[model samples]
Target: MDIIKNIKEKGDNMIYILDTANINDIKKAMDIYPLSGVTTNPSIISKENRDFLDILKDIKGVIGKETMLHVQTLSTTCEGIVEEAHYIRDNVEGELYIKVPVIAEGIKAIKQLKKEGFKITATAVITANQALMAAVAGADFVAPYVNRIDNISGSGVNVVNDILNQFELYNLDTKVLAASFKNVQQIADVSNLGVDSITVPLELLDKSIEHPLTDWSVQQFTSDWKKTYKTDKIIIK
Candidate 1:
């Protein structure tokens, strides 16, 4: 029942997060799995065609106060980014982590937000150098897009690995929140490296814990038990 203790015993305490803003998907994922947070981007938000603040509040209502909600800033300027960060904090309930990109203005905004005592998560990072810059800027978390990196002739998992090594070498406080995964294997491989967390789509979330052989074995056990007991249900006094 102690999840943290079990994760420590397994030698990996990787946090799981759902990477979509769909309220139904978030509710379903949390109902079926142990999730630490939910992450969103401009692209994900654009899909809903709904009011941004209402969607955020609805997501918070589903995930509750215990889970972290990550919302990205759409601004490309430091001032605009800061404004959006403040608006999100003022409107959204519970703990919020504002996601800023690793671009020029974004870095400046991150530095400013950090100085102002905000929970900053640097996102859309394609290279290890970008992640390093986010760390140097004092971000609470850095997200490396795994599948997107591979699409551009680079290894996404490798980028995450390199960042982890750099964070360890320099003793940075930033945690890598790997994102943009197309398959379950990408998450499994990165979890082995002991990355801090990963945000995956709902479709691939349950796949990591399922196997066809396991289902077959369970069916066989049920059949054998029914034959011996003459009933599928357990009898109790």
Candidate 2:
């Protein structure tokens, strides 16, 4: 179905998955050229030791123009969440996606945010039903914690599968963002399953570039190139 072409060319049914723990990391990820957006939670922001607005501004500056930047809301009440959503949207540039929990208050805020033309993501979700509810609430993204679910009982992949099936059946626009990835296998599995996108950590992104055969072939090519082309200096035109 030319999935990559459809994703990058048409921009239909495609999502950008980013792994960012801090502003600098988010900037680095965006600098990679293929990153579509950055995702963060309270825990990730807390580790930066910078004020929330300052960190957000830094991220926006790095990931400018049409990139999606998600900021998680900590408030439990719908009113509080809505207020935070407005604050984030007002203060941030480009598209600001508010990350809310999958609880009732979050659903309420999501509905209102959608009505107000604000992008929203329902995060910390672990079940297919939660994905369903988030879609029904008009969430732009539904983030399922794959590794965290596996860490507790090892049914994470199944949850993702169910959510994908449900999304297909309902023709929902809420993209399933497989998150909390622990290894390369999980990334490959989710990508193969056609989950909309997966938010991996920095370590896993590095691991994705590692393959024993690929490494060996690259080393062989470099050695052969050095042996064949002896000169290291370039001639002036």
Candidate 3:
């Protein structure tokens, strides 16, 4: 119990993570929302064009140590993945969730990392079996590519549901971290079924939170308030 205490995840509500490496956007989101953390892959980080330490450290500075930072491994071999994990662990100061693809080699690395008490997020998951195998390998989280599955004409939401059901059936503690959202609808669909964690691109997250009716209603309230009171702010009589 003590060995895996820090890495094990159990929560009643979903956790939200920003799937971006844009430092300015991350800082803005952290200031505005109750964001849980940030997630980055090689593709995302490559866009930043900064050294790994500099990019990650800048994110850490904005989000702070309490928030989780999920960084994916570029290696495809178990040995390489383990070495990369160690490198990141030695440099980063926080609860870093190592994102590994749900492949043969990645599963092996996850098992080794789990034993060493590293927080593992098995990413690139498209099937229930892959998620099941990763969970069996003791992954703290399994990230199923929601939109990517749908793009291939598969029901991403159904896959996510199946993954959640399997975890419950097996009595495993691995959380489902749904990823690759193309739209807010995908996020909402996954949210309805029960996602332990979701890393949303800012555009989709913005869509998820905003509505024209919401804005109009707030505008109406402010207009009505002005008619009754001289001050725009709410206060006691």
Best by lDDT: 1
Q: Enumerate residue pairs that collide in model 1.
A: none
**Sliding window of 10 residues with minimal summed lDDT for model 3:** 1-10
lDDT of 3 by residue, 99-158 (tens): 999999999999999999999999999999999999999898899999999999998999
Which candidate would rank higher by lDDT, 2 or 3? Answer: 3
Tell me the alpha-carbon RMSD of every candidate.
4.6, 3.7, 5.4
Better-scoring candidate (lDDT), 1 or 2: 1
| TM-score, ranked from best to worst | 1, 3, 2
For model 2, the stretches where C-alpha displacement exceeds 4 angstroms are 1-14, 232-237
lDDT of 1: 0.90
Write the residue-wise lDDT of candidate 2 on 1-237 in tens digits: 222212222554445567675765666666664777888899988888978988888877888857788889999999999999888888877878899999998999889989999888899998889989998998988999999999998667788888877877787777888899878888777776677877776667767887899989977777777787764333524
Pull out the clashing pairs in model 2: none
Q: Residue 149 of model 2: what lDDT?
A: 92
Candidate 3 runs further than 4 Å off: 1-11, 235-237
Best by TM-score: 1
lDDT of each: 0.90, 0.80, 0.89
